[model samples]
Target chain A: MSNTISALPGATYEGAVRVQEMGLCGMISLRGDHGDEKLISAIKDIMGTVMPGQREIVHQDERAAAWMSPDELLLLLPYADVRDALTRLETALAGTHFLAVNVSDARAVFRLHGGSAREVIAKLCPVDMSPGAFGPGQIRRTRMAQIPAAFWMPDEDSVHVVCFRSVAQYAFDLLKQSAHPQAGVGLYA
Target chain B: MMILTCPCCGVTGEETEFHQGGEAHLTRFGPGSSETEFHDYLFSKENPKGVHLERWRHAYGCGKWFIAARNTVTLEVYGTYAAQTTEPPQDIKDTLSAKVPGWSWREFA
Candidate 1:
């Protein structure tokens, strides 16, 4: 045993539409005066890009998205490299008054991938997850699995990252339960 | 089913996640700062024609407390920011100025 947990331990049950997996990925909450040219510059220099691209998947230096405000952005790195990422960025932007909060434990991420995933999410969440309403490369904050979450539906069979980690198992149970009936029981009915 | 439009997440949610922190941009007392001043401080508002920057808690939700700017007249939201921690940016100021003119920056600012 020496395997630290898989950042994404994909959880599954038979005949499920969306893949229910908890990503133990390292998550960071970044806040600062984004208006400060030097601060933004420092971050981009250290991390290559200060802002999450229009899409949910980063493709270049990992993936990220804007959580809400213009001044703040949420940056996610490979679970294992977070400490290194934080320390490097911290020194790089030392005096710029940027704060990097390690929220890996406070929030959990669950990935729901697959075309049937949208239909599965739509059942519990009121937000639009369809290609027409919500498409790839877009991330949105909405209520999901009965918990507040940021939904990043980046593509078909796409990735939907659900945060608020404590609720992950609860959400998993709910999604599993709700989506379960759709897939239906073999002979239990 | 109370629906809260999250500035971060957009207009999609059940009221369960958000906590309403009463009204935003409180009214103040003069230098006199009397008992009635304290009372009025606790209760008063502009509750007016345009955008209002109120505090909302994504309580049961994100557990993060943030402020939301919504227009009372149009019910159109302007923006949101972390509570008590930071001031909004220039774009927000410029947008609000154009949207809600004659706003006393020296006062609520």
Candidate 2:
């Protein structure tokens, strides 16, 4: 069996926004035609959830799927179940113009909590984080400082960020700096 | 920074959320086309100083590509539309005409 390690090495911060690395989750990049009934049905059968619409996320317990684009969805689940899920999905989507890639190691994910989580993200990304604009349960593919990243909010006080594994440390540092009380960055409304 | 609204996601955000894809509505010249045609298709671009239509992607938002009409000098975004279109819609043309009389773009111009 192969071993896995956290990108941030057990790093955790307690500040205005609590930042912690969400280590070693199974991530799959799924691309298919959402308008195709066969593909949709197969994905539903394998994932137990239909593909999410633009900026939408469908979550069930430890499994979640977020729409990456019009024709792409990112599936997140327990690391142990990845092999089983891939097999089932491959069997269901046979002979179709679809792509399922195991990208768990390609990216690192982090969860930010506390009341100022949104503001801290706002400092790094240009997308509107206000409740009126980007509310709870919405996912967006954007940039963190200069790094490509994606993030979503499960509730009013929390956000989950995923960035390329190579820049995991830089992303974490940027988040940590933004969470500082004296950072004093202006948030766009 | 300028704000652009994505037609796909209905999310209006800063320029950072969108990537500029340069001139839109180009007639792609592939193999069998003349040298001039290929040259025009590959290099010659209309860098108009006035109203221009462009291709943009909401890379950070919906991740869908789109098109936008804007002014180069004024930085005024006339509007944004779907990327699948072959040319600017009538409404976009009307808006551009209203903003600048006798405004024409490429074949439409």
lDDT of 2 at A89: 84
Best candidate according to TM-score: 2
* Residue range with the least summed lDDT across 10 consecutive positions in model 2 chain A: A180-189
Scored against the native two-chain complex, candidate 1 gets a DockQ of 0.23
Q: Which stretches of candidate 1 lie over 4 Å from their true place?
A: A1-10, A53-57, A181-189, B1-18, B30-32, B43-109
lDDT of 1 by residue, B1-109 (tens): 4455555434445555677785655555767798887877776555666666677876543345667766766766666665664455567677788877765432554
Worst 10 residues of 1 chain B by lDDT: B1-10
The CAPRI category of model 2 is medium
Leading candidate by DockQ: 2
Q: What lDDT tens digits, residue by residue, belong to model 1 across residues A20-44?
A: 5765677777787667776667556
**Share of reference contacts found in each model:** 0.29, 0.71
| Residue B103 of model 2, lDDT score | 90
B1-109 per-residue lDDT for model 2 (tens digits): 6688889877778898789999998889999999999999999998999888899998766678899999999999999999889989999988888889999878884
| Pairs of residues at least 3 apart in sequence or in different chains that clash in candidate 2 | none
Native contacts present in candidate 2, fraction = 0.71
**C-alpha lDDT of all candidate models, in order:** 0.62, 0.85
TM-score of chain B alone in model 2:
0.95
Tens digits of per-residue lDDT for model 2 on A63-117? 8888887788899889878888888888888888899898988889999998888
